[model samples]
Target chain A: MKIFNYFGNYFSNRETFQEIIVIPVFATLLAIFLGLLLLIVSGSSNEIALKALIALFYGSFGSISSISETLTAATPLIFAALGIAVGFKAGLFNIGAEGQIILGGMAAVIIGFSFQLPFFIHLILILLVGALFGALYAFISGWLKATTGAHEVITTIMLNLIAYRLLDFFLRIPSIQKEGRNDPISKSILDTAELPRILYFLDPNLRVHMGFLIAIFAVLIVYWLIFYTTIGYEFRAVGKNLEASRYSGISPSMTIILAMSIAGLLAGLAGASQIAGVLGRATPGFSAGIGFDAIAVALLGRAHPIGVLFAGILFGALIAGGRQMQVSADVSLDLITVIQALIIIFIAAPVLIRKLFPWIFR
Target chain B: MYFKKFLKISSGAFAGVLLMTINSANAFTACQVTDVGGVDDKSFNQTAWKGVQDAVAKHGIDSKLLESKSETDYEPHLNSMVNAGCDVIIAVGFLMGEATKNAAEANKDSKFTIIDFAYDPTVPNILGQVFATDQAAFLAGYVSAGVSKTGIVGTFGGINIPPVTGFMDGFAWGVKHYNKVKGKNVQVLGWDPDAKEGLFTNNFDSTDDGKAFAQNLYDEGADIVMPVAGPVGLGSASLADELGSDKLKIIGVDGDWTQTDPARKSVYLTSVLKKMDVTVLSVIESVKSGSYSGGVTVGTLENGGVGIAPYHDLSSEVSSELASEVEALRKGIISGSIVMNK
Candidate 1:
């Protein structure tokens, strides 16, 4: 009854709830409608398009395995999205999450394969090293922004290229690379370092692991930092008005650096989680554009922690469902990307949604 | 008016949903999961898809393809195909070797074929389709040397991967062979088979890098250039066309550039064919006919698995005597009389 009252009180706060929930839901529906329109324009038969949509939904949540796949896909996006959302609160755009992710994952993999420790300590050390490396990588850009006024957008993008080349070069080292393979393949992490599967008893095919729980905990921690902490207040103040924040005795530079460091820490955790929990080994293109996609997740989620979580899952469902759509209805997986782009566009331009469905605003 | 428009759209969508509920069943379904290059790569993935399409036409087997945007998509795509009841799954590219092997091991009943790679301690349900493209590339090399008036030819790769370097090695060897027989020094630039190093774009996707590398090679007085860089080679072909046929010639790879990109036919000297389509079609046919077996099927020059494409418009430029010599060289290579450095 107490929990029900807490939820009721939360729901009774209509404006905040609507801002956080209603707009995203409506934008998603509108995007799907436009996606169906795109399918029709592309000469897909009505039945085929409908079947594809059904397959997409079913593939996401049809069974326990399907649900597990969705969660698995959502895990990394959630972590990365939360990281992006943290930066958004501080008025900083960390486009370098992709590089940070690669570096962090590489750091985790190095520690994961090299060490011989107990399971609990090993997992904690791996995650810490991964997050620390990610933070350090982002701090360079943040420090540059503070001291030299070099725009992070340009610096982060350049850093991403450097990170890719660095990973390629590092993978070539005979010790780092898997033995007997000249190709850019890394050795698998030791079994002790791996995140135990959550559903191994039911079916070992379920790749979901403790990483999903870690992501949820990160979300709670981020929420607490943003709404219930002093640094969070300063970060928001700097974001809202930098001059006023300076006038009020908040050092904008300090807030910016801390914000970016925290952001990188979260992104790094994403990389480490993916490596330790899902992919036991890193390949040349292992990060797989998830860092870039997290930008969309952050925007669609309205740069809020709870919003980012739901948006990550939504994007995860789209990916998981895309394969099923391809298998069942013969639709191209490219359609998922198109739909994702459309959703982001619709959400970004809320006026378009308002104009299309004016009654929703009323 | 808005209400009416919404009603009409909703009705149409409802009708679509109703129609979609009825799906016809097919007897056998063949599915392919492509590498990060996707289906329209105009290279291995595209040619292998043609083979799946051929099976659709010949054996009436239902075909579908799942394109992997990244390496992470491999296992999920394979699992989805298996769960969706695909009778045979074709995994393209060496990047997919591990994922396909694992999937095949798990689902012993499901037949699988992987192109461009093979597994050690082979799984019973999986067949490896690998091509010895160097032999055909040697012929291309010899012919390229025969036609170059500048007495210089160059080749570069997308990466130093084996499948890619195989073409380069054979081309260099063919040029060496040409030099040995004719007693003429035809310089082969960009690759040294002995050192196993060459000019590479370090990536398969960059056309600008391809254009720059080919431009540099052309600037070095090499009139014939072979690029083993997928679509990146198209940049070199375009460069050759811009330079005119008299100034430069391009040796294409994977499929005949003449057929793949007919608009640029005049620039193509010849393509060192991998014949991925033919091999893929044969695998599908075996599955359809219940003759599918798990083992390595080497596509070599002797069995018509790999060969040089017809010289197309450049045939008029080649002397009959030189063409016959190139053919004899191919036969020699196939018969083991002329062994390649592989």
Candidate 2:
């Protein structure tokens, strides 16, 4: 009920609500319309396009099982995107979320496989270790930017390469690699550390897990941190005007470092949740560009926590439904990527969206 | 009168669609979930998909395919195929071993064949298609040894997995077999079968690594190079084009390079074939005939499941004597007289 009330209050703000909610919704519809036109122009028949649309809808939301899959896919996105949103709020473009997630996931997996603790304690320790690893990895970029006045973008991109190599190296270790497998595959995490499936009692096939609940909890905590906290105020203030925030006794360097650390922590949790909940073992390229996708998620959400949550789920729906579209209509999954790119384009140019949908703005 | 005619045409089209749907409802549906490499990879994924296409044409069965863009897509794609009521699902590549196992265990009613991986305990509903590619690679190795002007042949792998090493091991053994038979010295570079270690690019997509490996082998006095890396072998082909066939000849893997790239036909001596299409089609036929059972199906020379492709443009360079010797070696290996691993 409290959550409902929070959403209600958040939606009641007319000016930001129209910009955040209305514009994005229209943009999504427009992108889908354009995507259909693209399919037709690309030589797919009208009948096939209609089947794809129907299959996409049925796969995403028409069944309880599909909704479960969507939520499962969204769980990691929500965590990572929240982290990116925080960085955006602080006027930083931290592209190192990929490295942070990889490092965090690596830490979580090592702890998850090596330890033999009770269920509750083990899971908590894994998540915390993951966050700490992510924080330290992201801290390098933050420290560089704060101290040397170096750009975070360049450092973070370089760090991502290191992280990828580091994962490859770690997977090769005799202890870390799965037993009897020469290929670079990791040991499965202990069941005690697993994030239990939420709806297993109802249906064994439903895969949505406890990490999704943790994501929602993280959203609430981040919402409280960003909107109702002093640190968040400093972050926003520094973002709006760095010199003014520095003059107002909000040390810009400290704010930048702290904001980046918080973002890293969330991204780390994203990695941990994915390892603990979905993929029981880690492999090379396991994060699968989720960190990069979070950047787009944060942009589409306008750097708001609630908005990020919706955007994550929306992307998750595309992924889950994209499979159905492929199976039922024989459409390539690249079409979904095209649609997503289009939506982000429309979202980035809000004035264009408003001009296109004038009645909605009025 | 115009409205009545419009309604009649629309209803006729609707009835035709209904008839088609009913026809397909009874048709055997075979689905495939490719590895991260995708369907048009021109290697295992493409070869395995060819089996489905062949089955579609021969048996008039319905078929569908889902290309996995990442490792995470495996389970979901497999489940989607199950939900779509596919009679059999063929998962391509070793990377999908775990996901295919889990899916097979959960959906026992559905038959499954996983290329390149066989389960340990063996799931009752899944058939693991394991190939004796070493047998074919051995034949290619003997031919390489027999024809080498430099008295040295080289090979490298994409990774140190069993499938890749199996090819390496057989090639080395074949070279050794040639030395034993002819009383001549032929050195095998890039692999030590006894030590079970060799040069690896650690990835299958990098043509640069392939080119570099081929260059290094050539510098080391190897006249022929075989790359077990998937598309990475294309790098070696390109290098051979630059160096000319007199300097270096190449051996391809998974599919016949001569057929895959007809323009570069001169560069390839003979490709070590895995015969994935033959095995994949056989698996589907088993399902259609209600004889599908879970176990390992080994593809070997005796069954035409794995062999060496014919030397295309390089046939003249490979003496007729060496060609017959390769055929003899093939028969010897099939009869268990010529052990692949020395």
Candidate 3:
């Protein structure tokens, strides 16, 4: 928490890899170590799980294209993490990234299916529309908070539920949904909407897509906005002391609305990235709790932009590695979730983490 | 701390080796991935897993079931099976069509038997087994229509996917056919096919949602309801059991609900039966013989792929004359004497 003072409206001094990569690497190792202990204590053989872990490593990282999948999973998290991190920096916890993503994805799907445009134009249309829709969604909670003094936590949670139903409903549009059929998912995006694989020359199935580009750009934009802009000052000022920022003539409500809208825009872009760049279509529960998971990323990264980037990478690796781990080790994927929850617990209670590892924290 | 990471990886490896060596001694290998729902789901996943276990006990196959929590779990579970050297991998549900297709293609030499729906591109080393659920659902819909006191029957499905919707469409058609043939008008309310959003918990794991959804239909004066959701369908049965007192009944799907839900026989009028156990066992047998290949395995009423399970508590409800009438409807459906259109 002492890092909060140093995390002022600046760039190079505020960003570092230690909190992101170095810390998370150590944390993940520790979590896995503890997970293995639990396995042995439970009377399950660790040998089986170990081999599965090795296989997972090879499946995700050893192969030339495996890193591509790892990157694929990371890209969305990066966008999502950036969104949530930004939300935290602004002192508004927008836990509705999941809902925003869904809404964004459906908006993208609607645009992707309803119009017939050039490939480049079609792709851009989906991206902008999705992000715009996401901004509009986040604005709802912002409006509620601004008007009725409602807590964003409750409203966002309710909004997520509402978004889930709305996306499912959106997929029912005849042109957007399956033609001549009723299923919760829209038809696959047009070929033009498909985010071209990054390494098509090497192997067509490798998952590198345009979403990765968008994610990196998103991080860069986030970094720039937080460190170099006037809006950034107002945002930080409001988050630090809403009453004082208001006293300083910065409209707290407007800043809150803008912060949430920007955060939601990034989140919606995450959805568009996943659909156009990863999944290629909208389906129920498609966001897969990345929004909630992004909160962990923000905390683990100490709410630093560069740190969130690396944190997103680590999470992407774990998820990417999970399949391989399960295959090679025969360790259940539940182990991964268990490991993630543990890391979050430690991250949430950094003092407990320090207590567990006195030397490292000191 | 670094040493801990090393120990974690090594010790876990040590444990994995020990278990593999032990399980290798088993006779036959059985592997299954439950649809989005786990094995306890009373529908396809549960019935299908039971079939594998039954096959394991009967055939002495060493079986392992991998419960998929979500779509992301598919590739990993299938890969784990392949890593474990499971000889026969059976994927349950049509939603698994694309996932199984992709996994099957990657592991060409590994024999696979996928139940329900085939990928159009088709993998060379996979067996796509689909049942004649339409034929079976027709039977259930007929019975529900026949047994309805209010003449207003109802049906709702989880996902509106073809396989799930196919059952719904066929059920509605069968109900309509029954009404037209008897020269009687039986009201029918089905899950709206053209709803803005498809009605799927997507999880297929929640029984409570299924129950609540069914109760709404029951409250709307539906005497009989058929749920296409797998295990979640049991929720409908639960509500049907409670509310089925005088004006409500539920038609079960996938397996013989009479055998599965014997205690609640009073509420379960009959089940649309797809002999999933037979379908799975046959696929396992083929893999054992080395003839497992990519092709559509169609199960129709002609092959006993579909039918109406025998009445357990409703034996008295179906008089000997009504039983004959049900039998005639089945024959008519089979012989193309009756074509059901939805």
Candidate 4:
């Protein structure tokens, strides 16, 4: 009974409850409706489209293995999205997450292969080094923003380009590359450095690891830092209004630098998790586009830590299920991107949803 | 009004779900997972998919395709096919080499074939399909040199990878062979066969970069340019068309440009063909007939795996004497009289 009351109070006290829950749900439904409409317009039978949708659902959450795959897919997104959410809270648009992710993964893989230490210590040290590298990569943009008023958007994009070339250059070096192979592939991390599979008992093929748990913990830490701590207050204050924050004895530059550093740290953890947990080795474009997708995840989550967690899982499910949909229903996987775009469009413009369902708002 | 719309959508979705639940039983299921370029890339992936489609049409085999949006999708896509109970899985592109190797090792019972890349320490269930495309590209190089009025032909790649550089290396050698035979000092631009350095866009998708590379080669006084970059090569064709065929001609790669890019057919001198479809069909056939074995399958000019496409629009441009000369060179390369250094 006390737990119920605590939950009720938690819900009632937050004015953002509707923004965090109601709006996103409504937008998702509307976007799905529009996606079905598109399927029909594209000449797919109603039965075929729905089968594809069901296949997507089953593929994502159908069984233990499927759920494991979903979590595996979501792990990196959770870290990167939370990082983006934290940056958003501080009114900083850190578009350098992709670059940070690459550098972080590279750092982790370099340390992972170089060391021969005990399991937990090795993992912790590699993750920390990876995060530091990511933080330092983003610090360039943060420092530039603080010192020269350079927009992070531009700097981060340029940094992303540089990071790509730098990775290619690093992979070409003889020592870093795989033995007897000229391709841009790095050596596989030692088995001891790998993040042990969480479900090896169930089925050895399951790829989910401890990264998901770490991501959840990061979410809690980010939530506490954003809403409960003094630094959190400063971040939110600066985000709400830079001039007012400066006048209230908050150093805007310091806040900007701190937010970016923390954001980079989270994004870096994402890279480290992928290397130490999922891939177990480094390859060119290993980050894929997860860092970029994190922007959408952050926006859809309304830039809240808890929101980002669920949002990451949702995206992960969509990705995992999209493969299943392709396999079972014979639908093109590109449909997933279309659905994602539609959801973002509806979320970005809430007026349309409110206009269509005014009674729901009331 | 919203409630009515919701009812319509729900009913449609319900009907769709019912239709999807119906399963079809088949004797064999063949699946393909394409690289990041997807199945409709109009290059390697597309051609490989055609082979899968051919198996479905001819052999009554169930077929499915999954496109990888990025590098991360490779493992999952392969795993999904394995989970779906596919009898044979085909992975296209050199980028999928590692994932295919890992998948083949993990699932020993499932038969796998990889295109454009060979695995080291071969696995029992996996067949690596590789093409000696340098042979065909050599033909393209010779043809381009013979057709060049300015005594200059150029070639560039998407990256400095072996598959890409194989085309450029052969093209450069063809030009070198042309100079040795004719005693004419025809210069090849963008690549130095001896130094192994040349121009590359470092990507396979950007048309603008392809156009810039082609333009750069042309600016250096080359009338013929061959771009080994995938979609990037289209930019070169487009630039060739824009500059007028009188000033420039393009040598296409992979599939024949006359068929792949009909709009720019006029600029295509001929294409260096890599018969991915033929190799893929053969692999599927082997799996279907219970004759599949794990080993390397090399596609060379001798086996019709790699060859030069016909000079379609440019057919009139090649004299009978020159056509016979190119054919003789092809025969020489196959018969061991002529050796390609690269």
> Each prediction's Cα lDDT score?
0.85, 0.87, 0.75, 0.86
* Clashing residue pair totals per candidate (backbone < 3 A): 0, 0, 24, 1
lDDT of 3: 0.75
Indicate the TM-score of model 2: 0.92
**Candidate scoring better on lDDT of 3 and 4:** 4
Model 2, B209-292: lDDT tens per residue? Answer: 989999999999999999988878889889999999999999988888888878888999999999899899999999999888
lDDT of predicted model 1: 0.85
Query: Any runs in candidate 4 off by more than 4 Å, and if so which?
Result: A1-13, B1-27
Steric clash pairs (candidate 4):
A47-B16
Interface RMSD of each: 3.7, 4.3, 5.4, 3.3
The window of 10 residues in a row where model 4 chain A has the poorest summed lDDT is A6-15
Compute the DockQ of candidate 1. 0.50
- For candidate 3, please provide the TM-score of chain A on its own: 0.91
Q: What is the TM-score of chain A alone in each candidate?
A: 0.95, 0.95, 0.91, 0.95
Tens-digit per-residue lDDT, A162-240, candidate 2:
9998998999899999999877889999999999999999988789999999999999999898878999888887776
Model 3 alpha-carbon drift over 4 Å, by segment: A1-30, A37-43, A49-66, A113-122, A325-331, B1-34, B51-68, B71-91, B98-113, B118-126, B177-185, B191-203, B241-247, B258-266, B313-316, B335-342
User: fnat, candidate 1?
Assistant: 0.52
Error of 3 at A191 (Å): 3.1
> How big is the positional error of residue A11 in model 2, measured in Å on the Cα after superposition?
18
How should the candidates be ordered by DockQ, best one leading? 4, 1, 2, 3
Comparing 1 and 4 on DockQ, the stronger one: 4
- Taking the true A–B contacts (Cα pairs closer than 8 Å), what share appears in each candidate? 0.52, 0.38, 0.28, 0.49
